[model samples]
Target: MLRAATREAVALTGHLLRYPSGIQPEQITDPGAAPPPATEGEGTGAPPVLLLHGFSDNRSTFVALRRSLLDNGWPHVHCVNHSLLTWDVHEAAELLGEHVDRVRRTTGHDRVDLVGHSLGGLIGRCFVQRLGGDAFVRTLVTLGTPHAGTYAAAALPPHPLARQMVPGSDLLGELAGPTGGGCATRFVNIWSEHDLFVLPAHHARLEHPDLAVTNVRVRGVGHLMLPVDATIAAWIRDELGAQPTLFGAAAERAGERAGPGRPDAAGAA
Candidate 1:
């Protein structure tokens, strides 16, 4: 375990060194404006997939996974890098709503797919479940997101967003509420067994009586790796590419992937 953690840590260091290159200039532009060149790509009739990163992370994390998507017929892939200084999930949800609208308009598609990692997953969920984002999201795939708050947040330095992730915060209280039964958006929650930052780790699973969720268990992968591992990325592309599930009964491929390595940078969540 020690050797594996060391290897993952080194891999993350390489990502950090190259992170500066992945910075999107458009993040400084108005959120209401159309996305920049980074969001541009050819369409293959597949709904555009928007990649959302975790807390304090940028679009760089999804480079490998995004390439896998674009290479495998999921041509129109976009990413949203929200301000790291932001405070509340509710506010971030609103920002996500605006961006989702822009992505739809920019791609000329009414509905799109979402793949959010860690905190990105919660932000996407808050938008879909709280802010009527279901109308715009066709398939929502979260990678290692904490649907219920995680004890991992307590280990981080206190911040507003981190506080909201403290297991039973008021914001989580809102997420704990009953979701509408009529929500048509398909939810695929892909969580890793080796994600140490999610506390008990199972907190990443989304199990609501009202929502039909496809929970995929990934083995031997870490929180940060969920967005980058090649094998898992292929699985994600296949999941989104699969035909839509009808009558609110999406065929659940409830299983695990034997992905490589273990959890990366604890601060990534």
Candidate 2:
């Protein structure tokens, strides 16, 4: 009973999945002789944005955003691989930190923006909070992130790693607890009212006053529809393209020194 459009879309997705669609290292670098740094503190500035995909998904999830950012002149888009089928939130955080450092070093920028989906958002938060990532990230945007637990976890197998995402589980609670470190980063959480994986839409919204969390309402979008829709991309671009509305006296002064409205001023670290 599949519609012609649906069948065509499925075939196109299959082709994209099978294609080597990632942006490689050489592709990110150049031959002007002033190569991007290999570590933090080694460049003019770090890449402007970083994209992290959700669980069971690959770097291709952010393909559209990557193209958009590049076309918008915000290059240095890197999508992370979460060691899928063997997920580890903590390790994923560490890996994310390393990638952030790499971007900082290579691009010579001190801070970068982050866009994450689902579990990738949790992992990004961990990086900002516990993995010394606050110094390198400016803005954090999450799409369909389960700030609480997802009801769909109930149907998942009782595997050790899978338990991390189980609804009402201790792991999810720990992630939600106050870590007391990455308090300065601005955050935006996007969610869909019709997400089948996460019941109680609020489960996807973070309730932190210090965090600039925006609970976006995308209509009729599913849990696994990160790249299947256009609204989320527009939301992310809008959030990242704006300046933070709140910053204390100390941070505000430092931000002013960096130049207001510029990407560097928005740098959280």
Candidate 3:
């Protein structure tokens, strides 16, 4: 536990250097029409993956995780950042839509995968659920994301982004409510027992009736370590490689290292 906390503190220092990274080009808005997914050799068959950082953070949060995916077999991986200055979640989602479209055009992939941490996860979910992004999102993975809203956010009322994350906020209500097409995207919601920003912990676990959500319950791993932990990175790599129908099997694999005091924390199928 001490080790994880120490790393989190170390990572905080890097945040200063990584703030507001991964800015998309303005030309993305007028990036012409979309193309089809690339086949083998042309960046491989797997869809390109996008990583989003937490509140006040940047793409550097994914330095380790991104390398792991690339070293394995994922050919195309991109890290996108949302600014803290953004006033509304809805606008962020809209901008995310543009970035997604631009990535699809660049990689020639019709659909892509998304992995988000903290506030980034919520924004990604808003794009997928509320902005009709499910059609192009193959799988959505969230680490320590407050899917049900977090009281921790209420502490920063001055930031509109923070206010939208408060429990029972209007934006939160809209996301929780029904979407017109239901949840077409495959969801892997990873919530750690060690996360404190999520307030009451359980809020990090998503329980949506319409979504095919695999609520992964992990222990000991802190919020900041989610993107850098070796084991978690391996699990996410495997999960992304697995077929959508085999999500249950992947969930079980997430806790394959269970032994002694560290019993399995796998989620229900």
Cα lDDT, all candidates: 0.75, 0.63, 0.76
Which rank order by TM-score, best down to worst? 3, 1, 2
What TM-score number comes out for model 1?
A: 0.83
Colliding pairs, model 3:
none
Q: What is candidate 2's lDDT per residue for 1-269, written digit by digit as tens?
A: 12323533563575367335543321234333435443322122334687877766567667677777666656567777765555578888887887776666666667888988887888888888767677778788877788787777667666545567677777677766776644667777667555666667668767654454555445445555544455456545655766343333564433222211224433111
**Candidate 3's C-alpha lDDT?**
0.76
lDDT of 1: 0.75
Clashing pairs in 1: none
lDDT of model 3 at position 3 = 55
The weakest ten consecutive residues by lDDT in model 2 span: 253-262
Per-model TM-score on C-alpha atoms:
0.83, 0.73, 0.83
lDDT of 3 by residue, 1-269 (tens): 56556767776676556544444422333346655557632235778888888787778789889899888878888887777678888888898887888888887888889999998888888999988999989889999898888898878657988888888999889888887766779888878766778887888888777777777666767778788777778678766886442234664555322211145433211
Stretches of candidate 1 off by over 4 Å are: 1-7, 25-43, 243-269
Clashing pairs in 2: 37-106, 39-105, 43-108, 44-108, 45-107, 45-108, 45-109, 46-108, 46-109
Using lDDT as the yardstick, the better of models 1 and 3 is: 3
Best candidate, lDDT: 3
lDDT of 1 by residue, 142-261 (tens): 999988879989988878988888888898878778886577788888887778889888888888766668777666667776787766676677668774432124334443222333
lDDT of 2: 0.63
Using TM-score as the measure, name the better of candidate 1 and candidate 2: 1
